[model samples]
Target: MDKIATVKWLDNLCLVGQTSSGHAVVMDGPPDIGGQNLGPRPMEMVLLGLGGCTAVDVIMMLQKSNQAVVDCHIEVSAERAETIPKVYTKIHVHYVVKGRELSEAKVARAVNLSSEKYCSVSKMLEQSAEVTHDFEIVELS
Candidate 1:
């Protein structure tokens, strides 16, 4: 994998990640110290990356099961220990799925499967953080 980052302006950074497929993702950083609204904070990017990874796992799993997944949202909250490392002690993930007559059992099962076996992000997080998951299903109006 190849990536690049070019300095744009004061306290601002533009980052890119290149995949083996010749695809790229551009990200940015801001001067957190001076409150420069240049780009997203690093910690925010970590959460977003984790969310994106798990989201793909959940959506693809539900789709493969023919669950008619119209929409799926996952909210993640992590408790960081107040120390130098500031490692996350616990993480709570709440998944809200929307579709036409979606199944609660299927949603729960999908989330379980992802956290337990499917989602690489969840598994990676499990090494250092206590990750938990819950879900709510909404039927189309």
Candidate 2:
């Protein structure tokens, strides 16, 4: 299915993005670029999307497997090119899974599946950036 979104200029270097699904997000540039830094940059939103997409996939997969998941966090980091149209060169994703007696093997498998097959954002970014992932499981007392 095709998704639709619109970004409207709010003010100097600030814009508001609205999705067809009825979600909204604010974006802005740095002060040097005439922005107030009121919100995240557009590139930062890309990383956020990547992290959110994969986190959802991993959490859902774990829950489907009957794992007692309590919390899931995803950290995404990236490097951009030095030239104009600076696109991401490399991206790294880290997953921290918290639960009771979670199987290490299952957690690893879920992370792998999300990065390799399930996450659409990951697949799209990997076209131009080298995307890699790792995970750590935190056992609950």
Candidate 3:
């Protein structure tokens, strides 16, 4: 599938971009970079994308496994290279999963599968960054 987006410069260091799916996002650099802190930085969007990608996979895998998952949250952290062409060097995805009778093995397996096999974002980021994951299961009565 081919995806596309258009980024329109809104102001100094600020831009508004829209995806082929018609979803819009605002981006800007830090104040030091001439941005007024209008929205998320472009690099920060990458982290958000990664989180969204893996969260979807984990939820889908749990559903397919007949796991009763009520909620799922992911915290993504990363370290970026300090030099030019700055890129992510290391990344971590921490998942908080909630449900009833949520099997520990299933949760781990789902996260592993997403990180190792299913999540395209994870796979792509792993090419440049060391991606790691940890998950916690919260049971609800």
Candidate 4:
């Protein structure tokens, strides 16, 4: 399937983007780069996209395995190259999964499947960055 997006400049280092699904997001650069902090930086959005993509896959997989997934949070940290056309050189994704009686094996499997096979964003970034992952499980009473 093909995806489409439209971006319109919103003056002074800011832009409004609309996805083919009609969802909209605002992107801007730093004040030094002429942004007024109106929204997230474009690079930040890439991190968010990776997190969102993997989180969805994990949650769905856990649900399918009958795991009680009450909450799921993903944190992504990245380092960008210090060169022209800066790009991500390294990325680490940490997942915090909360639920009652969560199985570690199942959770690990879910995470591995997403990072290794399911998440397109993660796979794409792997070409330019070293993507690594870890997870922590929080059991609820």
Candidate 5:
């Protein structure tokens, strides 16, 4: 199935995006580019999408494996090229999983599966950037 989205310019390098799922997000450029900095930059939104996608995958995988998950957070960092059309050159995804007696093996497998097979955003970004992933498990008392 194909998804559709719309981005409408608001003002002064600012825009609003509506997702196919009916969610709305505001985007803006930096002050140097005449942007008011109302919301996140467009490239930042890409990282946000990647983080959200992987977070969902990992959490669901853990739950299906009968792991008692308390929280799951993803941190995404990237580097852009120096030249024009400054596309991302490197990207790293970090997963912090909090749970009760979570199996290390299962957590590792979940993270691996998301980056290597499940996460579509990661797969797409791999075309232009070197995407890497790692995870740490936090046991709940």
Candidate 6:
């Protein structure tokens, strides 16, 4: 574990994370919501983190399998409970893969590998929601 954040108030999570050069990511929550919003809403960031992680994994796997990846897109949708203890109940991930000579099996395998082994965010989110996925391949000009 690394250095942690101590909450001085509600909605506020301050962390003292250091860069390799000893610089810091001085993050804060929104002041109106008892933080600075400088670090972004935790939930929002979570979604992006998942997308980024899975995106990299997909790209890597496709490249290794020799797919000429022109571009990739991931869309994430989540349903959250509207209550005090809000949590996601369902989530759907759609992957749009644009390339040349793309194999559906290879794309499926890449997605599976990311969700099963590489993406930590997806694994954690799975505990809360029934995560589902689908993919489409688009040939380029």
lDDT of 1 by residue, 83-128 (tens): 9687777988888899987777877777888889987877887898
- lDDT, candidate 4, 1-141, per-residue tens: 686998999899999999999999999988997899999999999999999999999999999999999999999999999997899999999999999999999999999999999999999999999999999999999
- Let me know the TM-score candidate 3 reaches against the reference structure: 0.95
Off by over 4 Å in 6: 4-40
> Weakest 10 consecutive residues, lDDT, candidate 1?
3-12
**lDDT tens digits, residues 24-139, model 2?**
99999999989999999999999999999999999999999999999999999999999988999999999999999999999999999999999999999999999999999999
- Top model by lDDT, which number? 4
lDDT against the true structure, each candidate: 0.74, 0.97, 0.95, 0.97, 0.96, 0.80
TM-score to true structure, per model? 0.78, 0.97, 0.95, 0.98, 0.97, 0.75
Candidate 2: pairs in clash: none
Task: Kindly report which residue stretches of model 5 are placed more than 4 angstroms away from their true locations once superposed.
Answer: 1-3
For model 2, give the RMSD to the true fold: 1.0
Decoy 2 TM-score against native: 0.97
- Tens digit of lDDT per residue, candidate 3, span 1-141? 676998999889999999999999999989997999989999999999999999999999999999999999999999999998899999999999999999999999999999999999899999999999999999999
Clashing pairs in 6: 29-35, 29-36, 29-37, 30-35, 30-36, 30-37, 31-35
Worst 10 residues of 2 by lDDT: 1-10
Q: What is the lDDT of residue 120 in candidate 4?
A: 100
RMSD (CA, Å), each prediction: 3.5, 1.0, 1.2, 1.0, 1.1, 4.0
